[model samples]
Target: MRSILAVFKREVALYFRSPIAYAIPFALTLFFGLLFNDTVTRNNQNAPADVIMTFIPGLFTFLLFLIAPLLTMRLLAEETREGTLEILMTLPMKEWHFIVGKFLAAWLYYTVLLALTLVYAGILWRIGVPDAGIAFGAYFGAWLYGGAVLAMTLIWSAVTEDQIVAAFLGAATILVLWLADIAAAWFANLSNTGEQNSVVAEVIRELGLRAHYTFTMAQGIIRAEDILYFIFMMIAGLFITTRIVEVRRWRS
Candidate 1:
């Protein structure tokens, strides 16, 4: 446990010390800040909180679509390619310790990036009233969703030595899940307007990444099911990552 935490801290520190980490977060924050300030206006005097809450989660998820894969691409790929894995694997650390530590470290970095976006809330306060509850819940949901995305990216990083392949696979997987709802609809309804046939598609829609997030997060309603879904995904991906590392370690 202690070793895992140590590794986790080291991983985060390493990222912070590098230029890639600094540049990625800074670029994303500025880009998103400009976007939000433009799309979200204070004209109608509607609940600016709801608008911000919904916008931030989707925006962060979009950023993760780009950053998450790149972040985890080097997690295992670079370690093995640079020959650092040989020394690290020979340590007294267990496979679970290594995977969980690295995964947790990546997750912590993700949390920090999301936290830095809190400046948006201050902007909201300056422009209009902020919905504290909605903003908080939405960000919390976004964090969990991003954690799941990062976990899968980490799994892909372990499977291959090529960072490009890792990033493509990670992004592709998210894209597929993101489109699950629409694709499911097309499949469920042959004519695209049927009632009974669409039921099957509607059922599949619940599994879509956007659906769960929109229902729980967009409306400031945090459901246990959505939280559990993200947790389940994180555990499943990490477990598989540990299994893969264990196989490679013993085989070679």
Candidate 2:
């Protein structure tokens, strides 16, 4: 536990010190601020009940596709590239401890980014009565969504010593998953019957990152399955990362 905390604290400090950390929040603030302004302006006198939805579904998810890779690309990749991973492995700490600590640091950093967007929500509160349930669910789901993304990207980081390669792989994987639903739709359309029930299409849609969040959490309808999907992703991602690190340690 102490070893984990040591790594966590070190990584968190490193994150705050990094220019990318500040840059992400700055970008998010500008993007969300503009989005909220435009949404409220277009709506005029009556704020939409689903104002947050405007931010979550499309651009936000895309941002995650980009941001997840940027944040995690250097996590393990830098360590391996610099040959510090072997040094760290020689310590008394367990591989899972190191992985979890790094994961928690990155997760906390992403959480802070999400928290910064709450200012827009606070603005919605002053002007109108937004549905608290929906707001809560959307943000909660987004948090989970980001955790899953980070975990997945960290796997790429674990596998490669080149940060650029890790980042590219992470982004490509995320893009594919993010657009899985669209790919599925295109396949169905090609069938000429508009058959959404093709077994292949169904599986593709289910694998989409948006499928778990857009309809359910974005709409304030929280389902156990949706939550579990992200939880499973996080757990499985961490497990895979741990195994990779363990294998590397043995080889070193």
Candidate 3:
């Protein structure tokens, strides 16, 4: 427990101290602003707070693919590159401790980034206060969504020693997931009433990150299943990360 806290503290501090955190968040905010502004300005020209809130969470989904890799690309790869991982392995702490702690730190960093986006709420407030229930749901959904993305990228970090390789793998994997969502949408829209095709609909729905993000969050309906799905994904990814680190240690 003590060792985990030590690692967590160190990693949390490193993220704040390093320029990587700022660089990624700034890029994300820039992209998000462009998208949200375009939607609000064009579709609902001179819209109210509730309408903008509806648009922001959906637009926020795009950043998951672009910025999530930044959180995990350095986790184990940097240690391996610097030869620090070997020394850490020789210490009293086990692999899972390091893995979970680092994962938590990264998770917290991403979660904070999501929270900072509440400034969007403030912006909305300047126009008019939106529905509190819907805004809360949207924020909650975005938080879990970010958690799942960070966990996915952490898996890439555990296996690869090169940061570039890790980042590429992370981004490519995310891109595939995004593409799967699009394919599912196409399939889902094929049938009349979007039903009568159970197999196709089920497969497509399962692959949809945006389905959960848009309906559950932006629509202000919190679903237990979606939240649990993200929790399961995050835990599964980190567990695999621990296993990979353990195997790497055993090999040496």
Candidate number with greatest lDDT? 2
lDDT of 1 by residue, 117-229 (tens): 87877777777676777887788889998888898888888999899999999998887777878887686868656776677787777667777786667567888888888
Model 2 regions lying over 4 Å from their true place: 45-47, 52-58, 189-197
Number of the top-ranking candidate, with TM-score as the measure: 2
TM-score, every prediction: 0.91, 0.92, 0.86
Each candidate's lDDT (Cα)? 0.82, 0.86, 0.80
The TM-score, computed over Cα atoms with residue i paired to residue i, of candidate 2 is 0.92
- Write the residue-wise lDDT of candidate 2 on 53-123 in tens digits: 43643456568878888889999999998989999988899999999999999999989988888887788
What is the clash count of model 3?
0
- Local lDDT at 101 for model 1: 91
Show where candidate 1 strays beyond 4 Å. Answer: 41-47, 191-203
- Candidate 1 has what TM-score? 0.91
Top-down TM-score ranking: 2, 1, 3
Off by over 4 Å in 3: 27-48, 185-197
Instruction: Compute the lDDT of residue 109 as modeled in candidate 3.
Output: 85
Per-candidate alpha-carbon RMSD to the true structure:
2.4, 2.2, 3.1
